[model samples]
Each structure stands twice: as structure tokens, then as C-alpha cells.
Target chain A: MIVIENVSLSHRDTPILRDIDLSLPRGGITALVGPNGAGKSSLFSLIARLQPLQKGRITVDDMPVDTTPSRTLAQRLAILRQDGAVANRLTVREIVGFGRFPHHRGRPAAEDLALVDAALSEFDLHSLADRFIDTLSGGQRQRAIVAMTFCQGTDYLLLDEPLNNLDMFHARQLMRCLRTIADERQRTAIIVLHDINQAASYADRIVALRDGRVIADGTPDDVLTEDHLESIFGYRMKVEHMNGKPFVLHHL
Target chain B: MPDRRMIVLAAIALIAVLLFLTVGLRGNVQFVLQLRALKLLALLQVAISIAVSTVLFQTVTANRILTPSIMGLDALYLFGQTALIFALGGFGYASLDAGTKFGAEVLLMIALAGALLWPLIRTRMDMNLMLLMGVTLGLLFRSLSQLLSRLLDPNAFAIVQTASFANFNMLRADLTILGTIITLAAVVVSWRARHVLDIVGLGREAAIGLGVSWIRTAAGLLLLVAILVAVSTALVGPVVFFGLLVAALAERVMRTQRHALLLPAAALIAIIILVGGQTLLQHGLGGASTLGVVIEFVGGLVFLALLFHESRK
Candidate 1:
């Protein structure tokens, strides 16, 4: 379980996140949905310790995020930021291989290589594994990056907008892959998503944020109501039920 | 694959050394050989120091076009020497202990580099800002050194000029031994941290996400770069852009990002260039030109080409 209490962050004297308190349980998918400038990414950065904690405390499975050693935290949690750019001229396979660094620290045993192979196939990137990242298409590159993050073999995966640059088919495929990983591997994934219906269909719980505060947190049925989304997204959206799932008409 | 290339490069460097040492032995064999040996040692120290330091600096900065020399270290070195001559006079400066002089120059370079580089690294701002600041600082130091040079007496200026130029003929055995020791230590530490350096080349957030202590690693590598630039500048008076040439050539030749391979590859290339260029200058050119001038010409062209290539991309 991940626990957050009174976590507030300000950049250059302007508050980005404020007085947030929440506990995410183990072994399920949680989607963080919000409008633009809603501070979802900042919250993920704080949890990943990319940005130093300015106020309050967060613990991952009873281990404090701030106090734990980096290697220890890395083994338990992995994060993929949206703005990550690969400037090293590395091949897809080589980039994915770096995910095992915490486990092997440059001396990769056979098992690490096997895990890398598994990640490559898991993301349907086996054919493009040898291509350089710069040469790959945006959707292909996004899949490759996700493959690298998944190769870390962490229990908790926090991905901030992993669907960018992906086509609808690839995005759905990736969401399904994440769902499978969560259910089969017993790992928890907290993904920041913009698509409302995708989150409604896939996430076990949806956490809606507005102005750096959680305004709604519950199952999709409870949080995907037209009233709740209008309050969070600042617009009227038609929420209809299909096969016992809420489908949002926010595209218009 | 890189192993085979490394062997070929090592072989080439060995042949260069042989040709350099035995190509033309004249009047007194023993006396000439000893002098050439000292010069060879100095060349090796400078080559290793510059190549290793530049590669590491580029790794930490995540830039292929940067070197420790870019941060005004070599300019500061000249300023320090010019200041020493201006204060002590030519004769008094000559009388100072070589070890003391080398020690003082190295300390000053390290201090100045630290002051200029650490704050930027800590804040993690736009890297272009850091590069701009480095170039600006270098210009300032060069201007200051030029001003100092203008004020000195002709004779005093000559003394400083000889020390400032990249000349291998004035090798001192005591300073060579000291440099060899310091360069060897820095190389060993750099080799030990080779893997961390590879991870760092991935950028700061990626490195930190991979569990690397970003501040500690950057600080440690920065100090190592300062030490290396200090050693090479003290020994060779700064062969500007030569490190960029070697590193760029090594990356093209090795085709690998692993520092374990890149370090040796760059070192070997530096040795080949220095020793081979010296041989060509001495024998082929009949001492018509200096190796430093030739290197600066080639390195500058390569730097421009790299800038052009990157901009187009």
C-alpha cells in the first residue's frame, strides 16, 4: 500500500500541490484523471522522489519514500515520466536493458537478460528490438519506453501519461497490457490518464484531481457520473452505460 | 567487436611510439634517447589526462561537444602562469620550485572550475546556459591573461610565452613524475566509476530514477575533470580542442556508449594522434611546425563540423 499525508509542494513560492491525503491499496490499477494544470504529474514526481518532498510524508508498503535508500526504493517502485527524452543514441534493446540496472548494477546475469527478452515480447516489440530509438515511430517509441519501464520488475509502477504519441489501437493494447500485468503479476499500477472512458473501463478505481486536491475517489461507477466529471473537468459530458461500464462522450 | 578494434588501435599506438623513439637518432645516442624518453612520458601523460577527462566531462554533461577545457580551465592556467611571472619577475619565477609551481597552478584551476560549475550542476538548469557561461568565463580569463601579457617586460613576457605555449621540448623529469602519479590516480578512479558514468550519460532524471545519487556522482566527476584538466594543462600548456577531436573520433570508431570501452578507445586515439603527430612534425615535416598547431587546426575543424552536423539533425 502507498500512503500520502499532508503532502504540499510549491515551486518558486507558487503552490503546485496542496494538503493531499490518500492511501492507495496494493494489487490493482488506479487512474489519476484531471484537467490541464491539475497537478497530477507533480504528485507522481513527488511519489517517485524525482522532486524532493517539501511537506508531509509518503510511504510505500511501510517504507518511507524520503528516508529509504534510492536502490531500495527503485527495486520496489518504478516511474516513467512523459517528458523523458532519450539522448544517448541507444537501441531499443539497450535502453530496455538499462531497466535492470538496479538489480544487477552493470553485471547482468543470465536471468536479467531473460527478463529483458520477456519485456520485449510482452510489449510486442520483439521485431523492432534492434532498431535505434530515434528511428522508431512515435507509437513504436512509446511502446519501447514502456517496455523499458516494465523491465524494471518493480511491484509499483507509476506512469505519467504513458499513452502520448500512441495511436488508438496501440493505446488500447498498452492499457490491456497494463491491466494484465496488474492482475497476473499482482503488481499495482498508478497511471495518469487523460482519456476518461479508458480509465473507466480499465482502472479498478479512479481518483479525480482538480486544483491540486482530490475531488473524487472511488470505483468508476461512483466517480464517472456526469455531475462529478463536470465538476472536475469544468464541462458537461454525457456519461452513458455500455455493458455495465460508463462510456464518456467528452471528445466533442 | 570493440575488443578487436582496441587491439588494432593499441598496435597502431605501439608502432607510433617505436617510430617516434627510433626514427632519427643522431649525434649522441644515450643523451638524445633520454631526452626523447622524457618528452614521450610527458606526451603520454597529457594525452591520457585530456582524453579521459574530456570523455568523463562529456558523459556527466550529456554532451559530446564539451570538454573540461571548455570551462575556462586552460585559460585560467595561462592566467596563473602570467600572474606568477608578473609578480615574481622572470628570474624569480624561474628560481621557484617546479613542484610548488605545478601544485599552485593545479589548486587554482580546481578552485576556479569548482566555483563556475558546481552551482549550475546543483540547480539542474538548462545545459545550454551552463555551456554559455563556460564560454563566457573562458573569454574573460583569456582577456585577462592577454592584459597581463601586455604589461610585462619583453624579457619577462618571453618567459611567460615559453611556458604558455604547448611545447614538449621543455619537459622536466620531476614535473613529469608528479603528473604521471596524479594522472594515474585520476584514471583509476574514473575507471572504477565507469558504470556510473554510463548511467549518468542518460541524463539526470533517468540517472536518479535508476538509483544513482545524482549530486554525489556529478560532484565527484566534476572534481575528477578538474584534476585531469589541471594535470594536462600544467604538463602541456593546454592543447585546445584536442580532447574534443579525440573523443569525437573515438565515439565514431568504437560505436559503443559503454565507458569501459570508450575510455580506453579515446586514450588510445589520443596517444596515436600525439605520438604520431609528433613523429610527423619531427621527421616528415623536418620540424617545420609544432604538433600543437596541427592539432588545433584539425580539432577546430572537427568541432565546427560537429556543430553543423548536430544543428542539421
Candidate 2:
């Protein structure tokens, strides 16, 4: 579980997040969706402790983020930041293996290697495992990064803008991968998503923010209404229910 | 492949050592051998200290072209040397024990390095901007040293002048033991933290996400780099491009970014270059040239080649 209370952040006296209070329970995926400048990424950074907490307290699984040992927090929560620039010289396998660093520190035992291999296969990355990350395409590299995040063996995964460089096909593939990880492992993932349709398709719940404030929160269908979408995005978008799932024709 | 390359480098370094010792044997062989051995140890210490320092600095900054010298470390070292002479007159400096001076300088550099670099590291500034800042800081250090140097007595200024150039023949045996201890401790610490260095290459957020306390780790490595740079500079003056030279070559030789391989490989490469160059100058080539000039020449070319290649890519 992740709990955030009265968290506010500012840069150069310009408020970025204003008094955000949220409590998330375990075992499902939560999608944070909003347009640019909506503080989606900023809020995700705070949960992952990428940025320091400015005003209030945040806890991951009852351990306060500010005080928790990074190594201890790393075992419970893993984050893939938005601008994740990987070391180019490292092979995909080596990169994925680093996910176990918090657990093993540096020495990888048999169990750690086995888990890395499993993550590679789960992400369909076995063939590219030996390839250098710089040689891979952007989408392939993104998958490798996601695979590494999964290999962390943490309960809570925070991925900010994981679909940035992915094409349509790879984007959906990644979403399906997230769904499997959440459903099968009962892992709780909070992803910052720009594509509302992807969020509608995969998210168990949707939290909408506008200008650093949480404007709407509920199941996809409940919070992704035409009125709610207009308020959050400042524009109207068509919402279609296909197989009891809300699909937003956001491009229209 | 990495193991094979490392073995080849070790072999070459061994040959360089043997050549440096045996190239000119005459006149009381035992006495000459002991002197050569001492010189060999000093050279090795310099090589290892520079190689390890450069690698650590590059890793913490996540940059390929950066060396501690570029970050104003050795410049600050030179500044420290000049300042010491200015504060303590030439007679006082000449009277001070070499080990005490080296120890004091190392402490001072470490403290100053932390003060100047901690904010930039903590703020997570862009590496290039930091590079620009470092270059600017280095200029400041160089200029201040120059200004202080101008005010010194001619005799005191000569002492400052001696600290600025690279000279291999005048190895201070008194300072060699202190430098070797610090260099060895740094090497061991760096070797133990090799895996962490690899993660550090993944940049700030990812390493922090991987459980690295980025600020603490970077600060520690920076402190270590400061120590090695100080030892190297204080021992044998400032060798600007030697660290950059050996480190870049070591990366190419090993063909991987793994510090476990890069650290040893870089140090060995430094031995091969420094020892090999000194031997060639002292024996192979008529004793007409300085090893420092030859190294700076070749190292400058390597730096340019790297920049050109990076631009092409």
C-alpha cells in the first residue's frame, strides 16, 4: 500500500503539486492520467522518492518515504522514471540483472540469476538479452527497461511515462504485459499514462489530475466520463464502452 | 575476451617494469637496483592513483571525457601547493617533513573538493553544465595560483613552479610511502564498489531507484578521487592528461564498462604507458626528452580523437 497525505511541492516558489492526499491499497493497477503540465509525473516522482517531499509525508507499505533506508524501500518498491537513460554499454541481460542489486547488493546468487532469466522470458527478451542496449531500437530498449523493473521483485512498481517512445503495437503490448504482472503476481503498479484509452483498457482505477490537483478518482468508467474528461483535459472526448470497458476516442 | 585482454595488458606492464629496471645496469649493481626499484614503485603509485581517480571521477559524473583534472582537482592541488608555500615561507616549507605536507594537502583538497562539488552533485545538475562549471572553476583555480605565484619571493615562486610541471626523475621517496597507502586503500574501496559504479553509469534516477543513495555515494567517490588526485599531484607535480589517457585506453582495451575490469585494466595501461615511456626516454631513446611531454602529446591526440568520434556519432 502507498499512502500520501497533504503532499505539496514547488520549484522556485511556483507550486507544482498542491495538497495531494491519496491512499492506494495493494493488488491492482492504478493509472494516473492528465494532459501535460498536469503534475502527473511530479506526483509519481514523489511516490518513488525521486524528488524530496516538500510539505507532507508519504509512506510506501507503512514505511515513511523520507526516513526509509533506500535499500529497504527498494526491496518493497521499484520505480522506472520517465527519462530513464540506461548505460549504453551494458547488455540487456546485465541491465536486467542490476534490478536485483538492492537484494544482493552486488553479488548475484543462483536465485537472482534465475529471477533475471525469468523476467527476460516474461518480457519476451531472451533473444535480445546479450545485445547492447545502445544497439536496440527504442521500443525494444523500453521493453528491456520494463523487464528490469519487473525483475526488481518489489511489491509496488511505479512507472512514469513508460510508453513514451513505444509505437502503437508495442504500446499495447506493454500495457498487456502490465496487466499480466498485476493480475498474476498481485503486484500493485501506479503508472503515469498519456494515453487515456490504454489507461481505460488496463487500469483497475483511474486518478485524474489537473494543474497538480486530483480532480477525479474512481474506476475507469466512473472517472473517465465526458464531463470528467472535459474538466481534466479542458476538452471534450468521446467515450465508448466496448466489452464493459471505457475506451476514449481521444484523438477525435 | 576481457580476461584475455587484461592478461595481455598485465604481461605488457610486467615487461615494462623489467625493462625500466634492467635497461641500464652498471656501477654498484645492488645500489643502482634499489634506486631503480624505488623509482619503479613511485611511478607505479602515480600510474595507479591517476588511473583509479579518473575512472571514479568519470563514473560519478557519468561522462566519458571528464577527468578529475578537468573538474579542477589537480588545479586545486596546484593551488594548494602554491598556497602552502605562500603561507609558510620557503625555508619553513623546505624544513617541513614531506609526509606531513602531503598529508595536509590531501586533507585540504578533500575538504575543498567536497565544498565545491557537493552542491552540484546534490542538485542533480546536467553533466555538461557541471562540466562547464568545472572548467570555469579550474580556470579560477589556475588564475588564483598564478596570482599568488606572482606575489611570492623568487625562491618561493620556484617551489610553486616545480609543483606545476611534470617531472619523473625527481621522485620524492619520502612521499612515495604515504601516496602508496592512500592509493591502495582507494583501489580496494573502488574494487569493492565496482558493481555500484556500474549502476551509477545508469544515471541519477535509475541508480537511486536501484537503492543507491546517489548523493552519499557520489560524494564518497568524489572524496576518493580528490584524495588520489592530491597524492598524484603532490608527489610528482600535475600530470594533466595522464589519467584521461590511461582511462580512455583501458575502456577500449576491455571493451566493457564494468569497473571490475576497467579499474585494473586502466591502472595496468597506465603502468605500460608511464613506465614504458620513461624507459624509452631514459634508455631506448637518448636521455634527451621528458616522458611528460610525450604523454601529453599522445594524450592530447586521444582526447581529440574521442571528441571527433563522439561528434560523428
Candidate 3:
């Protein structure tokens, strides 16, 4: 389980995340849903150790995020931030191969190569393996980066807005892939998403944030209520039950 | 792959060896050959140090256009030398042991690099801020050096001028040995940190995500790069943009992000440029033009081309 206790983060004297306490169990998709300036990315950054902890304590699988060695923490949790820009001119395979760096360092054994190859095939990137990352399309590059993160084989995967720049078809496909990875691999995925329907359809649990605080947290069915949606999003949205799942009608 | 690198390396080696033999032998004088060899060694040292250091610096910065000199290392070196000369007149400066002077210069350079770059690495300052600070510090040092030189006697000022210009022929043998040691140490340090460098080139956040201690790695690499620049500058003055040229050329040729390949490739390219250029200057150009002037001219053109290419792309 991942535990965040009394987490409060401020940037340059402006509060970004306030006194947040939450526990996330292993083995399912938890979609972090919020509007702009909701501290979703900031929370992810703190959790992933991209930024130092400020007035908070977080533990992943009983290991303190701040005190644990980075290599050890890396082996347990992997994060994919939105718009991950790698400036180097690396090929797809090479970039994906970096996922295994913690395990093998620079000297990659055959097992490492096998894992990298598997990730490439899983993401449908085998054909583009030799192509440089800058040459890949937006959706393809997103998939490639996701594949690299997944290849890390961490139990808890934190994806901050994985659906950015993705079209409807690719976005859905990525969500389905994540769902399969969570279900089949029994890994926990905390995905920060903007599209409400995607969260409703794919995430087993939906955690809603507003003004740097968690306003609602429960099963998707419970969190998708019109009242909760209105309070969280500050807009009236019709919630329809279709195929035993709440479908939010907010496209208008 | 090793075979291919070997083949390219062997070709360059063959050319260097041939140049080494012919340049000294063609003169047909025993003393002249020895002098030519010393000059060649000095040129080779400067080239290798700048090339290797620049590539390492760019890798840490994740910038193709930056070199170690961009951080004002050359200006610091000049300032240190001018300060020494100013405090101790020309007679005293000339009387001082060459080894002591070399050690003092290197020590001062390292201290300056640490003072200027350590904070950036430790605090994770923005790249723009680091560059701005480096440029500003460099300008300050240059102005200080000029001011000091202005107060010196004309004879002392002339000595300082000779010391500041990039000249291989005037290189002290002890300085060459000291430079070689520092350059090797920098190479080893960089080699040990090669894996981290590969991750660092992925930009800041990805490196952190990959569990790299960005601060430590950046600090270590920056220091190493500073030492390298110091060695080159102390030995033959500053060759601005030389590292950028070699690193850019290496990237284009090797087409690899792996520093294991990139570092050696850049080093080899530096050797080729230095040795080849020196050979040509001595034989083809008959030493009429200075190697530093030619290299800076080419390096400047390459720098502009890179900026244009990046902007266009």
C-alpha cells in the first residue's frame, strides 16, 4: 500500500497541495481526477521524488519515500509525467531499454534485453524500435514512454495525465492497455486523468481533487454522482448509468 | 561495432603516426625534431582536453551548443595568471619554478570552478541562470584581468600577453606533464560517471525518475569538466567553441546517445583535428597562420551552423 500522511506542499509561498492524507492499496486502477490547478501534477511530483518533500511523509510498501535510497524506491515505484521530453537523440529501443537501468545499471544482461524487447512488442513499437524518438508521432511517442515506464516492472505506476496529446482512439487504447496491465499483472496504477468518462469507464476507483484538497474519494460509481461532480468540477453535469457504469455527459 | 571503431581509430592513428614521422624527419635536423615533438605534444594535449571536456560539459547540460569555456573557465584562468604576474613582477614570475606555477594555476582554476559551479549543481539552479551567471562572472574576470594588466610594467604586460595567447610552441614541458595527469584524472572520473551521464542527457526530470542523484552527478561532472578546461587553458590558453565543434561532430558521426561511445568518439575527433591541423599548419601552411586563429574561425562557423540548424529544425 502507498500512504501519504498530512502532505502539504507550497511553491514560492503559494500553497499547491494542502494537508492531504490518503492510503492507496495495491492491485487496481485509481484515477486521480481534477480540474486545472488542482495540484494533481504537484502531488505526483512529490510522490515520485521529482521534487523534495515539504511538510509531509509518504511511504510506498512501508518504505519511506524520503529516506529510502532512490535506486530502491525506483525499483518499487515508477512514474510517467505528462509531456515527458527526453532531449537526447535516442532510438525507441534504447529509450525503452533505460527502464531497466536500476536493475542492471549500464551493463544489460540477456534478461534485461528480453524485458526491453517484450516492452517494445507490447507497445506495438517493434517496427519503430530503430527510429529516433523525435521522429515518432505524438501518440506513438506517448505509447513508447509508457512502455518504458511499464518495463520498469514496478508494482505502483504513477502516470500524471497520460492522455495528453492523444486522440480519442489512442487514448482509449492506452486506457485499455493500462487496465489490462493492472488486472493481468496485479500492479497498482494511479493515473491522473482530465477526461471524466475515461476515468469512469477504466478506473476501479476515482479520487477527486479540488483547490489542492481531496473532495471526494470512493468507487467510480459513488464518485460519479451528479452532486459530487457538480461540487468537484463546479459545473452541472448529467451522469447516466450505461452498461453498469456511470457515463458522464459533460461534452456540451 | 568494436571492429568498426577500431578501423576508424586505426586510420586516424596511422595518419597521426605518419604525420609525426614526416613532420620531424622532413626537417632533417636532430634538435628540430625534438622541438617539433614537444610542440606536437602540447597541441595534442590542448586538443584532447578541450574536446573531451566540452563533450562532457554538453552532456551534463544536455545542450549541443555549450562548451566548458562557456562557463567562463578561460577567463578565470586568465585572471589567475594575470593576478600572479601582477603580484610578482616579470623577473619574479620568470624566476619561479614552472611546476610550482602550473600547480598554483590548476589549484586556482579548480577553486574557481567549484565556487561558481558547485552552487548550481547542489541547488539545481535553472540552466539559464547558470549560463547567465557564468557569462557574467567571465566578463568580470576578463575586466579584472585587463585592469591588472594595465597597471603592470610594459615588460610584465608583454609577458602576460604571450601567456594569454594560444601558442603550442611556448608550452612548458612540466606544464604538459601536469596537464596530462589532470586530463587523465578527468577522463577517469567521467568514465566512472558515464552511466549517469547517459541518463542525464534525458533531461532533468527523467534523470530523477530513473533514480539518478542529479545533484551529485551534475556536481561531479561539472567539476571534472572544469578541471579539463583548466588544464587546456593553463597549457595553451583558451580555445573557445573547440569542444562544441568536436562534440557536435562526434554526435553527428556516432549518432549515439551512449556516452561510452560519445566520449571516446569526441576525444578521437579532437586528436584528429589537433594533430591533423598542427601537421597542416607546419607543412601545408608553413606556419604562416596560427593554429588557434584557424581553429577559432572554424569553431565559430560550426557554432553558428549548429544554432541555425537547431532553430530551423
Q: Estimate each model's TM-score.
A: 0.93, 0.93, 0.93
Q: After superposition, how far is residue B116 of candidate 2 from its true place, in Å?
A: 2.4
Comparing 1 with 2 on DockQ, the higher-scoring candidate is: 2
DockQ of 2: 0.78
Angstrom error at residue B52, model 3: 2.1
lDDT, each prediction: 0.87, 0.86, 0.83
Candidate 2's TM-score on the B chain: 0.86
Cα lDDT tens digits, model 2, B1-313, are 8899989999999999999999879999999998888788888998998899898888888877778887777788888778889999888877888777777777777776776666767675555666677688889989999999999999999888776776666667767877788889988998999999999888889998999987778878888888788777777778757787788888866767888899999999899888988888888668776678767776567668866876797
Runs in model 1 lying further than 4 Å from the true structure = B117-136, B298-313
State fnat for each of the candidate structures: 0.42, 0.73, 0.60
Per-candidate clashes, comma-separated: 0, 0, 0
- Superposed by TM-score, candidate 1 places the C-alpha of residue B155 at a distance from the truth, in angstroms, of 2.9
TM-score for the second chain in candidate 3? 0.86
lDDT per residue (tens digit) for residues A30-67 in model 2: 99998899899899888888888889999998999878
In the range B1-313, model 3's lDDT, one tens digit per residue, is: 5448746964895697468546647454777776776776776677778877887788778788877776888888888778888998888887888777777777787888888776676676766687778889899999999999999999999989877878777767777876887788878878877887888888777787777877777777888888888777777776655677788877766767788888888777777777777777778788888776666666567657867876797
**Model 2 chain A: which ten-residue window has the lowest total lDDT?**
A81-90
Point to the candidate with the largest DockQ. 2
**Chain B TM, cand. 1:** 0.89
